[model samples]
Target: MHEKDHSEALKARIKSPKRASRRMSMLLGAVALGALTTGAMLQSSFDVGPTPAYAQNLSAQVPAATSAGFADVVDHVKPAVVSVRVKVAVEGASAEGFDLRQFGLPEGSPFEKFFRRFGDEGQRPAPRRYGEAQGSGFFISADGYVVTNNHVVEKAREVEIQTDDGKTYSARIVGTDPKTDLALLKVDAEGGFPYVSFARNAPRVGEWVLAVGNPFGLGGTVTAGIVSARGRDIGAGPYDDFLQIDAAVNRGNSGGPTFNAAGEVVGVNTAIASPSGGNVGIAFAIPAETVQKVVAEIKEHGAVRRGYLGVQIQPISKDIAEGLGLDDAKGAIVARVEGGSPAEKAGIKTGDAILAVDGHEVKNARELARDIAGFAPGKSVDVTVWRDGKKREISVTLTKMPGEKTASAETGEEQGGKLGLSLAPASSVDGADKEGVVVVGVEPGSPAEERGLRSGDVIVSVGGKKVETPQDVREAVKELRKEGRKAVLMQVESANGARFVALPIA
Candidate 1:
């Protein structure tokens, strides 16, 4: 027989339902026939066994050990997760007629009569539109204290939490901190509630994690993944240090707990990155440290009191550092110190670079801001600053940031030269402080203009030294050139604010 005929015969035999009991036998017979045909064509021969050797040795093959499953972890943490539902009042006109067009029911259709018994579609005043939203939360105390996202319960007229076992309870907002997007809620239960504790330490990247929450209104949903990244700043707030995970966290997962391998709450799932409004593997969680801190303050005082340093600061750019004769670009450059603020009282001057706080090194402007805000008002701290090519430590006693709106001056003079600018003493200009030289005019295409120096700007300091008279500015520039410096750092105070400008020394 031809090889094609043999192949066709084997295919037909395998497809025959009558060979159901002999399915394996038919498969083996087909393989043997194919092999025999090839052997005949190639003029070679081989033995055909009743069964394959690999199949016979299946019992001897051992599978690799599998990692522990997540069932136990889910069981331990699922009870603590709760689904939060909120009802918000909506404002609009109420339609009072049965509008057939709204329900897609043809005008005067027979089906409309059947549905009319259910409700007068047009006569029903748009049932006082109540906006309904759902999210997730977890119990933090046995007495019924719960933790959820600030946005979840924000402006909610009625907040309710449903437990894993389907028991629902009305929850009241105890406090909320919008800066960190955290909120605390309370529920009343008779016996007690299953609560979870925040993890003492943060989870490492690549470590296994489980996110348990009510995703898409599905109660007690659990997803598993590893910590993808940490300390992610997505610009959600001023103190944004979120933990990024690859778990399938979707809508309604907000304010839920992300547990570690030990079933400890490592973070609170808050937001997700999805272009299609579904889980695409990227989600963000507020670290447990921040949650703990914010929660404690809320529980104690019913609000979060943040420490603030009254100073306008900016990051030290490469050009600013080079102009200031620094080897590395680090620390925050003090742009303007509030007149009566803690920084001003502590002798923290304009143009000073804040390098450290309480002996802890500050990396940049954001770090400095975060560190300062971590402390409480009326607390004293040691602030180290880099000034005049040297470091100096100053003591500052923080004060509560003012809640009221705060309010600055102007100048003139003309003196043009290699710097391509005009300067005059502030005393010569009206409404100007008599402490620096006033810039009356700037050459259209001069280096001063290129550096953002404009007319009416006051040059408060040059090369780390304060300037009083127009001659003081000229002398500073001459001294910088004599020292072989390529550029001079000028602290200019304008109506907008005070900032450092690096001007080239021609």
Candidate 2:
């Protein structure tokens, strides 16, 4: 996706695959605002994913540079970096849309005038129009296979790569995975090409790192910084494990490489957090661990397939922990179990707190998600969940993730008293769940609204007890509060599907 402005605090984000990494855009007047835009260095006008462990060479590249400098490392890996340019049909925009900001080109880019000559994006020209997207990439093999962000070549009519020697060559897309925001492109005319390897070890936070790629069309730009942090989720995608750095990552710098002291590619620059849509010393990169795994799949299968453990999940908050009769707020609570899913087949149910997977302790929701995705389809694994105050283990066979998951899930009836909800028996409503109470209304600025409850939502149960009417719903809340529960967990079924929403009792 292209760069977009944030009107408020990182509240909403607009992005599509194209050229360059994205940034957070919040239009803050006197205060601070935050927004996130993506499509990192070099074009599908810039859009950019989680990855598995990539096998890489562990041999030292001139040893780790000392505090003195990174001159040796930079000299070794710069040749592998290249500027990626994708020419798409003038009107060949993605279903979402595209614009100059999406392209992330510099002010003096040669094609800017031509794009404006035709007409505004709203007004299409009679003749075919040709627009180009640019970002960055580096060769992964001597035979000329390059790795870049998927947004760089999305909907591309043709691809052209510019090497360090100022030579341009045609390339073809091998495979692109939007989930990981990574793509593999092969150069047609193959000779021995300058290539780099993914880092064998993850870089430590505060360790020295270098970023190399095209920024604002300036090729071979090099900047140095330290790994600011690790395991950052920028809400870029479902699998959003990014490396945070302090390097100067700009619009045209997306898809570039971030290297550790060993001259190995540790990450691919993908996004930044800035209010003005420029560098603010804060940037994001897809870790080499994910990159190597994703690149390998694309090279071999021409597509990426991830494992799926179907369940609607949310974090176990402190209040929820008290309600669930647990001492600590850890692991992920199953809000809803997908019908006919591997989870459902394994006897997993709503309100089950997933504590471990295959004996590995589950820390939270994100950890569970990543661990599940790392597995291959058809693999049977042990899943342990805390149910009815005890941990039970079940085996589940994972399936291939579907394009779109249909929700078959729970919500509860409402009582306007303390919970600020109005309710009716489901039998009283024409099109409602057969066994629950319907939510007729939610009080304004009420706890129900804060938890996403709305009219027409069916409340199936409260505190694990089924409720069939307004009185039943009221009794459930009253009983839970009397038991010293801080919140009430309600199984709600709405238009989207059924899930659990916990509302505070105080």
Candidate 3:
């Protein structure tokens, strides 16, 4: 691949401006999109297809009178973009029981009268306030509906929206979906207003895109880039299907929209990867397809309702794949099935390798979880699993995830001298004194002692689920042995912090 001129419309959108008054949001968008497009073209240049055409036409028509360039797209979308400001009230320390006036207050009077003279009663100094944060958002509907990131409005007591024209409107939260970091707000505008429409299809790889948002409270900033990658999982949540771009999304750009060349909203700028809190070119956006679904759901219902498949799952590692006689590790491996839950009803069990759901391939447990949760409860779906070296299909009705429940603690008598290490329940400590199996006694030459298993460490989870007692540890070990897995990943919380330790169960 040849180096394209940075100003060849494709690269010009990403170059930094001469002054420091630069908009990080737009810059990061361009960088991310450029990276995405370059990677896609490298893999399959001829596969650019019609997607870029849809994107290019929108970008190419720069207004000639304005020295036609990327800013033209910015001008077209700026009116609909707005800055959201939030204020929060913080509570101060309470003097609940103490009474300074007790030494001299009137006998029958409550402390009110004495405290009033100090002006702390009737004029209770306004609660200490904190957040006065600003972020970017755009109108999604002509009827004054807007979309932004949930983090942009989180904990905000009052939200106000300010357009590029300096007019501000008081906005109310319509709904929010934290799983996707998206929120919807409304303003009471009298008539139709400028708004951006969502693209009917997902933005194709290598397509030009633009981002508009407020960065550092600077209003109505715009940047352009191309789609660098898709279906990126940065571990933000189980449902991470982020569109990676070279567009510069920085702080304050969290809630802005990314548009295709046709001026249609294609992505919602959410995050960027930069150590200095400025755009370094890598950014991520929530795809417009997911945004449309989430926004519509929030508008209809006050909250999101996701389906649940009750089972503990993990990605199939290479060792496990070879042990199971598989070609490669490319699916989710079921570790445990909830009794009487959907997995059990569908004849799914521990050690089953899940290949796909309803014909859509699942690359890992997180992908499977996200796909399943996209559906509503009681919906029937077909699951493909690899068991005993063959594929099988099972139909199951999804259920809701049960509320969090505490597991019983595992207690055991100190067993020492067997494993070269001392082991005991981690009790009587400041943090884990309440309920942790401790490692008390270690023999100098045992494997446990060699592995550095200490006395004060509290085992919190075995194989990713909380284990309350030592008996739970035994059960997990037994199950792992039965499944033929060699190691059990244990999450141990110590006074210092939490760390994962993979203990050999076989």
Candidate 4:
């Protein structure tokens, strides 16, 4: 995949570049609004869990910044960034026909609460259209080319762009990529439009950065902070190499840009670490290095074609690291190699730990996936791996993404100590039950394993929340932690019947 095309890929997923920035913004906004409504729940959950180690006995308050110099950066970048408003034609069947009554009763249930919260479902007929959703975006080119997250523009019938100066332009989507959540849009505007350029160099950690975006329909808001961290993954997607900044990014700032000291756009301010909609001093940015490449590719091509390596890989854990006889738990460990894949053709085998790709270090599976996906199909690259206590390198040609099949394993190997137990998708055995977590293998002394978890026991719920997939388990844990719950009450299913168990968690 071309570098410029990747951001475009990000754009394409979000909507078009013009609407994507706003789309990505809306996703975060929804999370915030949800959090705000459930703030009390989150606070209660926190009190129930073990206190954060970092906060133990830490009572001193940090002093506020004495200087207001950073405000200048926000003022400089605010003009180029804008709020995007979109009017989407929501089909009546898609929005109204969907049943909300099904979600109300269960803890992990999706819909019942929706009907109850909104009111008597039968009495209130659903609206024919969802009306309009507002978001944010920024200008990238002087010729009126704009970049945003794909989501903001997705499903929108009409889009409008508004700058800090109150100038508005009716926008049109160019293309969108759902995978990366980025989008591109163009407006019929005259030339000589003010635009921001992305910085070429990597912004230093702790370096001052400025965030500008519209927060909750509020226009032209600016906040400042330092780069908190880099390459932070928030479990949002596969390619989550976010630049974590300390800047205060709120709901409306979704598609806005995060700028470096030179006034160049360094990151697309996307998400923040907050239990509430307000900032908690941790925000994420789509790095400029990744953005520039995606933008350029979207400009040239309508879509992004990413390279694929047909293998299911996971992070090397201490157990696997010991089992594999490696020096340390680093790089991506191939759990299963797909048949007839580039890995198979290149002789890459299961248990082969990938160290690097094209000389770039492969820290983990996601990094390897992102790096491999960074290339177009048919591109060949060198891969270094550790097999049988020896380092070996293999050259493999990249393939198309959707063409590769994801392999399933029988062990709960890669999820680490996050979820209670390792599980695989349930497969029907004619007379066997389906639709629950099938415990293939559990770690000895683990919470689940210690609780008499067996190879075939199916988990139906966690802390009264249903467990459907690994994602569900993760969300349950997160919700448990948020609610200050000490133990996760799970309903387990087996060949005989269903029973409940509480798994204690720290």
TM-score, every prediction: 0.60, 0.64, 0.61, 0.60
lDDT of each: 0.70, 0.71, 0.64, 0.63
Q: For residues 285-313, could you state the per-residue lDDT of candidate 3 as single tens digits?
A: 88887887787766765445566677777
**Which ranking of candidates, highest lDDT first?**
2, 1, 3, 4
Error of 2 at 118 (Å): 27
TM-score of candidate 1 versus the correct structure, residues matched by position: 0.60
Clashing pairs counted in every model: 7, 62, 43, 47
Per-residue CA lDDT of model 4 for 101-203, tens digit only, reads 3433443355543543444434544334556766778877666778887667766767899977898899877655555567788878764556666776889
Better of 1 and 3 by lDDT: 1
Error of 2 at 328 (Å): 2.6
- Cα deviation of 155, candidate 2, in Å: 2.7
Candidate 4 runs further than 4 Å off: 1-68, 90-130, 403-506
How many Å off is the CA of 182 in candidate 2? 0.9
Using lDDT, give the best candidate's number: 2
RMSD of each: 29.0, 19.5, 19.1, 20.4
Clashes of 2: 62
What is the C-alpha lDDT profile of model 1 across 1-506, one tens digit per residue? 89987664444321101100111112121010111000000011111123322222111222322375777667666887899988865544211123455677666667654543445423543344477778889987667788988877765768899999999999887777776788999896565677776777899999888888877776778999999999876656566688989998877888898988777788998877554456777788998888888887777656666555678887888998987777889988888887777888889998998889899998877677777767766779899999998999999987654431010011112322367565777765667787888886554346775555777888899999998776677778778877888888999887656778788764
Off by over 4 Å in 1: 1-66, 91-128, 404-506
Q: Please give the lDDT score at residue 504 for candidate 4.
A: 70
Q: What is the lDDT for 260 in model 1?
A: 85
Q: Give the 10-residue window scoring lowest on summed lDDT in candidate 4.
A: 36-45
Q: Could you tell me how far off, in angstroms, the CA of residue 83 lies in candidate 2 after the best superposition?
A: 0.7
